[model samples]
Target: MGRHRNDPRGIAQMVAIGGVIVLFITLVILGGFFLYKSLPSGSDTAAVPEGAAGTTADPQAEEMPTGSLYIRAVGESSEVVVTVPGGDVLADTTLKTDEYLSFTEERTLSVTIGRPSEVEIYVHGERQDVEGEDPGYSFAVQP
Candidate 1:
């Protein structure tokens, strides 16, 4: 009763080591699901203010708004919210570390955002008067 010698090359090397451990766990779960969907998924929600300035009391002596809202920062922090509608002004602007914030306007704007930041609201004074449209402010950012 000694019939034990059926090694088909050790079951084809244990099925090629279980198909290389299931192709390395399916490429590490599709590379962690595309690195969690390329990160930066904070879902951006507020940022809109670029030109048309007149919150009174001097911001370079007001009166210059044909569109200009520029905030720059590659990394470290950013929060912006600028809303201006016939006077109930709002400004929560912040761009830290590599800092930069600018505005000039003629009234008419809207912005909502979050995370993965890099903004440049255009139409800036190419000799002014692109025919009015700027004045909207409320910004936010810290650290």
Candidate 2:
């Protein structure tokens, strides 16, 4: 019987096929990862009740068209002011430690914390870091 090996030709073809497979696998994994990350992490939330702009242990969540933002007071008492760009105060209330308020709106929201060290913000369950050491830590987020 004669050997059926095609010297370098067969080896080159096999190498090329292996390279293609690796490239395909890498792309698939990266594509899937980005797709998963792009999805909205927070589900639909309840709308913040109208005229409840005061102290509340747990304010109702807002059902905005854009996305979700979770703000929690981690101090004995924290003052939070959430407002829209056009002078509409979404929620102006004091949150007790461990209390949180959720806001989800299509428009941008500006959050001002009287005591920055006593608040925690979350987007899709990821904690956010606000840049301010003095009181009245302020930041704007679009959700």
Please tell me which predicted candidate would have the highest lDDT against the true structure. Answer: 2
- Model 1 stretches astray by more than 4 angstroms: 1-6, 25-67, 73-76, 81-96, 99-107, 111-143
Q: How high is each candidate's TM-score?
A: 0.29, 0.52
- Against the true structure, what is every candidate's RMSD? 13.0, 15.7
Candidate 1, overall lDDT?
Answer: 0.46
Error of 1 at 24 (Å): 2.5
Q: For residue 70, what is the lDDT in candidate 1?
A: 44
Clashes of each: 45, 5
